[model samples]
Target chain A: MSEVIVITSGKGGVGKTTTTANVGTGLAQLNKKVVLIDTDIGLRNLDVVMGLENRIVYNLVDVVEGNCRMKQALIKDKRYPNLSLLPSAQTRDKTAVSPEQMIKVIEELKEEYDYILLDCPAGIEQGFKNAIAGADRALVVTTPEVSAIRDADRIIGLLGANELKKVELIVNRLRMDMVKRGDMMNINDVTDILAIDLIGAVPDDEQIVISTNQGEPLVGSDCLAGKAFENICHRILGEDVPFLDLEIKTSIWDKIKEIFKKN
Target chain B: MSLMDLFKKKNSGDIAKDRLKLVLISDRANCSPDVMEMIKNDIIQVISKYMEIDAEGLDIQITQTESEGNNGNVPALYANIPIKDMKHTGPAR
Candidate 1:
């Protein structure tokens, strides 16, 4: 059976979609049959980020409503033959699909795929509930900002309330330069507040924006954050890989050397 | 000595004061290391019967101090309750 993982965050715009795209792509590149389900219905962007938006004729709602079969709604990724996408319905709301329906869908996909990724919507509403209902594990994404961390903590509390035990942290959109300047919170600072196991840290890369616009991820490239996502995927697959050094620890000497090098 | 040295010396004290303010705020607010007006309101509610406290001048804080053993420690909470300002209508008890 495929390991159903839900990528969610309490707050919006913290790179949930980007993390989903990268991790899902990374797992697919590893020759694992992966299916990503976008549960953000009516406000879907997972397909756009994955570069499979045009191929979405039948979506998650269609399958749930019995309008189409699950196989028909599942869009195949040309980049990775094993990667597929179950797109969200743009015309319907999240309530169109019940949690039990989602469980059934995941269970069916589990037989055919090695990994089933659920891209959850923002906020702790019905959409969030629907997205995490059938998942075996969850990845709580948060930025270093106070608001983002607070929302993540609230989500962690909610996850515990639901008896979901295997939860991990994914610190996204991290700015190393700002962290070094003490203008932003560090990883330890964030981890200390959340008090959870860390899975991955994706550095804030402008290249991500370019790649998203281009309808693909920067994963498999030498981009620092992309490499970190790949590492996270490997770790998820029970592979022991060294964590990326996304933390920028700059000393007085290092600063001076950088200044000297700039001249 | 350069003026930069003098400013550094002055800023060192300011930094300590700033850190003290932050630590106190964190303790009182139980959140980010910044003073919030909600803490002032809480202090007002606690001391309203005892004395007519100046909500604006009410200094509530947490002071985070360095420890030799631990790298980072939780800040200490300090609430300055003004006992002298308490109204004594009768003989002092």
Candidate 2:
């Protein structure tokens, strides 16, 4: 059976969709059969983010409504043959499908895939509840900002309230330079506030935006953020990989060396 | 006073007592810094009920000592509400 993982954040625009896309692609890159389901109905953006928007003929609504078979709605990725996506209905609302319906859908898909990734919507409303109904574990994504960290902490509390045990943290958009200057909160500060195990820390990289815009996830060793995503995938598979701190280090030796070389 | 006498300032018990007194007052009056500022303004308004209030020099602050352990803990809030000179001395004034 596949392990259903939900990537969620209570606060909006905190890289939930990006983390979902990259992590799903990372798992697939590891030769695991993975399927990503976007549950943000009506305001669906995952398909567009994944560059699979044009290919979404039938979506989650069709499968739930019994208009089409589940296998028919699944869109196989051209880059990774083992990876697929089940896009949400762009015209329907969150109430279009019930939690039980999502659970049944995942239950059926579990037999064929090794991992089922759900890109959850923001806020602690029905959308959030429906997204995690069928998941085995949750990857709570949050940025380093105080508000985002507070919201993530609240969401973790809610997940604990829901009896969800396996909850991990992913700190995204971290600026190591700002952290060194004491201008932004570092990973330790965030972890201290939220009191959760850290699984991945993705630095703020311009390449991520370019890659995201290009509809190609950065997961290779060549891309810093991609390697971070791959490391997260490895951790998810029960591998203990040491986390890499992406913050820049400016030591006196390097500064002196730069001055001497310039002179 | 000897060097020890100079160090013989208030002990932990005394400090804790002071802190407890202030904390109790603040807790009862539900007074915070923000609330205290509003209260200071209200005090000025009420003092303007009878006498003039020096708003420029007026100061209101709450101080509290936070300590750990039962042996010696100084925890208290000290509020200093200082009002400047006014013409009024008595109720009649």
Candidate 3:
């Protein structure tokens, strides 16, 4: 059965778009037909993250406003033949599309794809409502910071109020060394407070920066963050996958560099 | 700066967990059916230690009550649990 999932974080810059992009690509790689919808209308960037920014004939606004057909708005990914993206309009404001329009768009997309991943905008506003309007479940992303956790709790309560009870948590950009040193909250510390099943915990990796810059999903690469995202895909498909055990240890290159330094 | 600090200093992770629990109490107090459910579960666990209670008939909610410090009214947790039987042992504490 096709499922609609929204990747949302009430706070900005918590890796919602990255999770949506990678998970969509990962599902497609696993032979599932997936289409990603960028719901951040005024500030659209999922297209750039998917390396399909240059080929945008129509957008979500066009499809909802009847300017173009739904098929016309879909931009197919050549890398993964089963994956597609419907980019948001950069010029239109968030009010341009209502929650009903978003539900309508998702309903039509559901018949053609196995997975429909919506990249939600930051904050609890119209954009957030539009993203979660037709979602069967939600993935709340947060870092191990006080502000992020507070916002995540608020978002969870809001989701519950909306009668959307199937919510899961994703702790992103967790530094294992800091966690071991008692400087940062570990995964358990987060999940206990949030009181939700953890989808995945992505580590703070420089490779993620590179992947985002190249406008590509890191799920295909042999990186730690990519592997965490792949496990998330398996868990989304109802497969039992264990969380990554990121032990605190310096890289061998760091060890070699320390040996060469003389005080 | 020294090894002694490692033994004395509180782990920030623990501190964050404590702070989150307190902060969420207020955040979830507003229109939270989940918060009420969480409180209900907590009440059941704690009261279960003293006696056999009718779990099916338990009811809990957050309501305004008089503050102990003579301040204005504040939100309070109130629970009504029916007792089925008293445990042979005294309060677990």
User: How much of the real interface does each model capture, measured as fnat?
Assistant: 0.00, 0.00, 0.83
Q: Please identify model 3 stretches exceeding 4 Å from their true place.
A: A248-263, B1-6, B31-93
* lDDT, candidate 1, at B34: 46
Better of 1 and 3 by lDDT: 3
Evaluate residue A210 in candidate 3 and report its C-alpha lDDT on the 0 to 100 scale.
93
Give the candidate order by descending DockQ: 3, 1, 2
lDDT (Cα, tens digit) per residue for candidate 3, span A154-199: 8998898899988999999999889988889999989988889899
Shift in Å, residue A205, candidate 2: 0.6
Worst 10 residues of 3 chain A by lDDT: A246-255
User: Per-residue lDDT of A1-263 in model 2, one digit per residue for the tens?
Assistant: 67999999899999999999999999999999999999998888888788888898899999999999998999999999989999999888999988899999999999899999999999988888889999889999998775687678778988988888999999999887777655677787677557788899998888889987988888774766878899999999999999875643356786788899999
Better of 1 and 2 by TM-score: 1
Candidate closest to the true structure, highest DockQ = 3
Give one digit per residue, the lDDT tens place, for model 1 in A127-206.
99998899889999999876687778778888887888999999998888877656677787778667788998889888
TM-score per candidate, in order?
0.76, 0.73, 0.80
User: For residues B1-93, could you state the per-residue lDDT of candidate 2 as single tens digits?
Assistant: 679985777544344334444544454445667887787778766766566556667766554455665543343534343455456643654
User: Cα lDDT for residue B78, model 2?
Assistant: 43
